[model samples]
Target: MTNAAVDDAMLAMREIFPETPLQLNEHLSRRFGADIWLKREDLSPVRSYKIRGAFNFLRKAIATAGSGRVFVCASAGNHAQGFAFVCRHFEVHGVVFMPVTTPQQKIDKTRMFGGEFITIRLVGDIFDQCYAAARTYVEETGGMLVPPFDHADIIEGQATVAAEIAAQLPEGVTPDLVIMPVGGGGLSSGMTGYLGPRLGDDAFLMVEPQGAPSLKQSLIAGHAVTLAKVDNFVDGAAVARIGELNFAALSRFPESQVMAVPENAICVTITEMLNIEGVVLEPAGALSLTALASLDPAAVRGKTVVAVVSGGNFDFERLPDVKERAMRFAGLKKYFILRLAQRPGALRDFLNLLGDEDDIARFEYLKKSARNFGSILIGIETARPENFAALLQRFETAGLGYEDITDNEILANLII
Candidate 1:
């Protein structure tokens, strides 16, 4: 909670790796009309800020519980990798429990980091089930459980980022605003706890995935609230409930400061950063940067802003899905369920309605709803979003009956 503790954590972190860079980003600066600096935590050895908390937790644990104690953690993403890295660094035994559904890339990365020091167990179909199993194991074995973000030690460790930021900023230059992504709230709480007093509470903005607005809903309810359903598209940041300790640190902030960004919209940012800026960002990592595009230009114009680029643990296999979501969010792609007469020329007529720039991405025949008509699912992609309007106008003139299912979650999930 104190600056001295965070400073000590920051100093101790050098034994692991030097500070990640704080670099001025020209593309973001010009686009937002603000002087933007990216605190590139994605560049860390573990490819995230998770290592800071994991290291701090183990350091203090070994000092109090002795080096022989076994450390255990449950995670499917960055935290597991960080815990594994620290375990290998300290030459201590560790047990990592990950969901069975976790990608093999993440599991392999964690194994590589811990080497012989860590034992990984793929348990349960989801994180909650895996976490429950971990708790039972810890109870039976008396192994120390390293929570991803709820504990005081974890918060103190994440606070090191703020310490580094304070030292890394140009002398006599204060940031006008700091943008951070919020999941279980460890990083956001730690950063705000350390810098809130120095920069004033109003200087911070917290972003969350729209599918998992735990912090925003909690703040609105005046207490921590758990979401009943969560979309796991942004796996790294789709926390159903905000951590109790983390919420306490962030509760004072107004609800207005917490922005919930759509998962598809975040993919747009991910693709843009990768294609335009040569910066690959995971869905959660792109949250802060994605929120920048939605902010009022006047609010950040000519001001010094800092956006935390959280992590880059992206799987190349998901790139196609990311691109699809991005295109949908940008309105460059659409899916329609069209009705056509059951005749040979019907297909030609429907094809004629599409503009020159519109390209067919998918064409599926569902079934004949009537003897004279057939239901067809069609997906179209175009270079410009405006092309869809003209194509739809042509369809109306041609008397083609169609229903846009691009935004219909239920139908899209079941069919598309």
Candidate 2:
């Protein structure tokens, strides 16, 4: 709410950790032709901005309440780890409720951070359900509930990220733009709160995962909108609804200022950041950078831009899936269901139709005993997206009966 409050939180945070770097990114600068800087919150001890809010909330709570109050929270990933880390820092007992479906990597990380200072309860399958259980637990036990993004203290704490960006910029010069990823809007709103009065509204660009456009939808509807469902691929930023407090801070911005990045587009950014920039970013962390590709290059060509690289808690096991999604999104990979005549050489004919650049990634045969044709589930990976068009033309010439199921959700889920 106040710059003084955010400033105080930033000062308090210095006791536990050093400032995360605001590095001038040469690669992005050159690629976008903009003076691009990255606020590497990913380099935080807990590898995310979540710690700032969690720590600030607990500090204020303890100061106002007492050291003996049991703190409780619910998070699918990053926030839980942050809460656990903060609990260990203060040597206070904490209870973390996470969805049963949460990745094992996150669960392990939270435990590693909390050690004996916290107890983890695996609750319902999704975040909302898990959050409900956490609320119930807090009510029954009379424990202090630490909300991830909804509270005032949490917003003030997260605002330190903006302060760091402000202080770390060369000569304290203002960036023409500051891009931030929005989930429940904690970090985005917090940063906006800090920057709005200082830089005005025009300096910010907010990004959200396309699969979870809570902030975008809310801004459109003039109220916080709850999504019926969200694709949890961008786990840290796929919130179903923007937090009320967070939305209040962010409501002034027009919906056009916020961009929705596709899940696979985020994967491409994640891969690029890791391979090109030597920066490991989770899907949510890559949201802001991914949205840059959607912007008109002419607009950002000579401007100074700062994009917050929010987190780096990526699991190596998910890298393969990330690549797969990236390839699919690029149109270099596709899935199809082909029906071939039962006669011999039918398979060979279909195979010969594929282009030289086309590689068969998957071939599963489904025999229909009562039908004259056998069903083939085929996945093709090509060197370029255009190669797929040529290959499909060849299929038409061969008179192959097939259906492209790459974008068909039901078929993709059932077969692919």
Candidate 3:
């Protein structure tokens, strides 16, 4: 179906839930000197726009397939929760297949949302395997498999976010740019499908995690190309490949319109929003806004822009890692391999060089080299980012040999 039809379908969705807020964010606006507004999909009942797609897909399918028919889906995160929520809403029998390694909190939340209407099955170690198993079950049981994305119905449902954005804007206040995070690309595809023709060209920007730029890579190659490996740090947006249907919707745009937000930099945005603004955003949810920091501020200044915050299903257990990434990105922390003389006063002398704001966060002796020197692993955290520069000067003056390993992903995977 055409995007116009999707827009019509989405308009009828208001009978279930009101349009999510489209609030102008003063803090972000002042920071970027732009008329910045946030399309708060996080305010949905399921705390994500995923539910909109799930409900739309299920409601339409059941109308044709009839009640008592089983619906199945495989998702390790937001999609599973969305599917479960809609299953309960429809009072339909649903089976949710999730990766065995899925977090207990997420599993619990999905179960809670589904209540007695759904059953959970933990299968496979990662999402791919889980998806395979879910499809197998769907075939054997004659159940309908509800795809997380890459479906016409799901895309149509997600397009509602764009419809809401258009309706919520003040009269004559069309956004000059719309930024969205790309995961499996359901939301981006839906938004682009509905708004693409209406806005003509160059009206929106797509943001992807640095670790997973499936859409960007595919667009560059002029076809869909799956990554050999995907970094799951931003689990919400980390997909090996953009969905076929999603890529079709996005393919018309130039590759330059798609921006990749660095994984570490995204952590800085997430932590800042959480601590400073008291807003909790998952890594993917922060993707679109984080890209703003890398853009030409002049281009966005005085222009109305809408950034879709996709989801906020962050687990607090990963908070430390998030903070560590944020600190490193902000330059307030550094990890170094230091060569020190194996003498009693050697450690004391190095400690003396530290500024008041600098504190030793980690110190470990890795190996002994002869009787005169030792290899030390040191992590220093400072109150200000520039303090690290001064600390490096001190090391240089003292002729202390050190290698900064803060941003070394290889070494960090082993030690940090």
Candidate 4:
């Protein structure tokens, strides 16, 4: 369907929920030296843009099947909640299949939104297994499967965000750039389809997690290529492959338009938005904003830009891990394995090497090889990132042997 049709769909959607705000962000604008506006999909009723697709799909399905039809979906995050919310709104039966390992917080929120209208099935160990089971259930029960992405109806629904963006821009306000985060590519495809031809000379930047650059790889390879493995740090956006339909819509854009944001760097943005701006953003939600940091200031200076903050379904339990990742990304923290002499004065001597701003956050003796030496895992936090260089210089001067494992994923996975 054409983007105009998608905009019409969005207009119809306003009967259900108001268009999310498109507000200029002063803090980000000031920092980036640009006129920055945030398309606040996070403020949607389901606290995400997923509802747009979910509602659109359900609206179409209900017209065909009538009320009381069963709808099924497989998701462990925002999409599931969005589907649940739409089911409750339509007063239809819904079945949500989530991984058995899905966090309690997400499952609870999904249940809360669905209430009596939805049933939760915790099946399989991960999303792929749950997805297969959901498909099977849909086939067996003759229910409609509301895919998270990879479908035309879902793309048309998600395009509503772009429609709202077009309507919300004030007179004489045309965006010089639009930055969006790509998951399975629903939002990106929809938005690009709506805005690509219209925004002549204006740039569209697509951001994806570094570990899951499905769209980027696909564009480079001239077709979709499923990643062998994907890091699930940005759980919302970490799809191993870009959706086929979504990729077709996105294929027009040049590969250079896409940017890969590192998982660690995203953590930095998430923490900064939370601690400094008091805005809690999921990793995917923070993707576009994080990419802004690396953007050429000259290209964006004084130019209007819109960033889609896609979702805010963050679990508070992961906050500590987020903070830790942010600190490491910013170079203000380091982890080291120190080979320390097991003599009586060894600990005190090691402590004396620390700079004034350096503080030991973690100190554990992993093993003692003999009477003379011990392997110690030490994590140090410093006020300034540069302090680490000085601290490492001190270690060198002191002739202390150490292995810095701050960036070693293998060691971190095992020990930290």
Candidate 5:
């Protein structure tokens, strides 16, 4: 509620890691005609600001409640690492629950962060089930449940980011706008709480993965809303529901302050930052940066804007997949299901129909047993999106039937 407490939290954090840098990003400033700065939370000890809140919550609890308790939490992403890392820092025992499908990279990272201070349990195949198991474990063992977000202490810890940002900005240059990314609303809630009262008429914007519009939906509905399903591609920000405390903190703002970024669009931003700026960003981390591209230039010109780069915990192994998603989102790639005549030259004819700039990325035959016709699943990459129109016309002229599944979510999930 006050800068004094937030200041204390920031000072406490110095024992673990230095302040994440707030650097002026020349590339974005030139692109948008604004004085753009990036608050690089990505460079934090755990590659995220999650540790700030996670550590603060445990620190206060242990200081007041004594150190003889087992800390427990359920997470498969950044929060898990933050909890594990803090458990080691405080010399306390912690239990982490994650879904069985969580990547080995994450599991290994959590283990490495906690060392021998934490025990990890893989349960169920989804988050809800895993969360339930964690709750039951806490009930049975009377262990302390460290929520990912939503608690007063956690919000206070996350607010340390804003506290640091205020000091890290260039001297005498007040930020006109601060763009933040929302997951369970921890960061956004903390951000607005610490900075909103100070930014008299200036702007604050929040970005969330479109597939998980919990914050936007809740604001529209005038209450916290839970989504039936969520896409976990942006694993760090794909929360099904905004936390009660988080939503309460954010509820004062109007709906227009939040933006929903498509998952593919976030991937494209990730690729651009990595390729052009040599900065790696996780999908959630790219959310705030990508929102800048959608804003009207008139609103940003001559303004000092700060965008939070939330995390950089990207796995190098996912680079190829990320590049493919980026290309598809940019309209440079597409997929189709082609019904080709079951003739020897049919495949050759289809191949010849492709334009000079189009290259076959994938070709697989389904339903080969069909005597008259075969189903061909094809992936094509092109230099231009318009090239597809010409190629499709060629297919029609040859009496071939095809269905485009380029933007089809259901089909893309099942096959692509």
Candidate 6:
């Protein structure tokens, strides 16, 4: 896409909402020793950069197909809200197909954005099924399908974000590094296409959730590949397959430019941003920011860097899970199975083994393993990670037969 096209899209976007902020984050700058600017796409009307693509797609479609054309799209959350908002903006009718498993908060927000302009259909249990249903509906009704990322107009629309960043920076200034989260590759591809020629391909870093390394895996294989399974914890960036057009735009970059962050690590960033900066970020939205922790300090120090805060469509109900994941990632929390003597003072003995800073988060007694031993599940949270090592040493000294199940996914899922 040309600068002119992106500029035009940006100009039109003003009719819906003014530009989101491009703020220099002092906390991050102090920590990384870099001039870290945040592209606050989280503050968008739909709480994501998804609105830009949806708006551009709808506007161009209406221009060509005329005002009353019906628009259809398939999305789990962010894109659905974006499509709904744009439909309401243009006073056009839209149909949003969402997975049956989508959060009610997202469903309600999408409905609120669309108001009378859109109708929502909950189909299937996953995004792929919902998307297929949307395609079938569009074919039957002969309506325009506003894809989330895979189309030219959508990419051009998302390119406007890069345009805003270019204009928002200090006069005669350019970012030395641009880090962005990747889902279907819409925002990252658009930004890369717009900035690569001027800033060089080496300047961009694309982050994806470790559980769903669609772009990273695709880059490794020199083509898009579908993931066998994806963890939906980072729902916003957990795409199974990168879009074809988006991958084509991103294919020029080296595979190393793409970073896959652990899902639990993202939770740590989310909690930190919320508590430290009073910023709310969903799991996927925290991907880019979380990558900073893994970057070489030398690479970012004294550099002008921009990390796109992609979205803030977080549900408060997930805070506990987020906190738990964060603690686990930080090594401040752990789960274990202990074989205790099924006699008086057995519980007291285990309690005495815990360090002063160690607190019991969960304790469950399972069936008796033998006449004198009982299986017990224990969860402990400590002030510092080092305390766990000391506590485990004490357990060994006491001759306590304990199994650390913290990293055992299957066992933890089944028992803890």
lDDT of candidates 1 onward, in order:
0.95, 0.91, 0.90, 0.92, 0.92, 0.93
Per-residue lDDT tens digits for candidate 3, residues 188-285, read 88898788777866988999998899999999999999998888999988999999998988898899999998999999999999988888899999
Q: How do the predictions measure up, each by TM-score?
A: 0.99, 0.96, 0.98, 0.97, 0.95, 0.98
Give the better candidate number (2 or 6) by lDDT. Answer: 6
lDDT over C-alpha atoms for residue 151 of model 1: 96
Clashing pairs in 3: none
- What clash count goes with each model? 0, 0, 0, 0, 0, 0
Candidate 6 per-residue lDDT over residues 1-416, each given as its tens digit: 88899999999999999999999999999999989999999999888999999999988888888987789999988999999999999999999999999888899999999999999999999888999999999899999899988998999999898999999999988999999999998898899999988999999999999999999999999999999999888999889999999999999888899999998999999999999999999888899999988899999999999999999999999999899989999999999889999888988988999988999999998888888899999899999999999999999999999899998989977987
List ranges where model 4 is wrong by over 4 Å. none
Off by over 4 Å in 6: none
Best by lDDT: 1
Instruction: Tell me the spans in candidate 1 whose CA falls farther than 4 Å from its real position.
Output: none
Give per-residue lDDT, candidate 6, residue 242: 97
lDDT of 1 by residue, 225-275 (tens): 999999998888999999999999999999999999999999999999999
Q: Of 2 and 6, which scores higher on TM-score?
A: 6
What ranges in model 2 sit over 4 Å off? none
Candidate 4 similarity to native, TM-score: 0.97
Model 6 / residue 76 / CA error / Å:
1.8
* Worst lDDT 10-window in candidate 1: 346-355
Give lDDT for model 5: 0.92
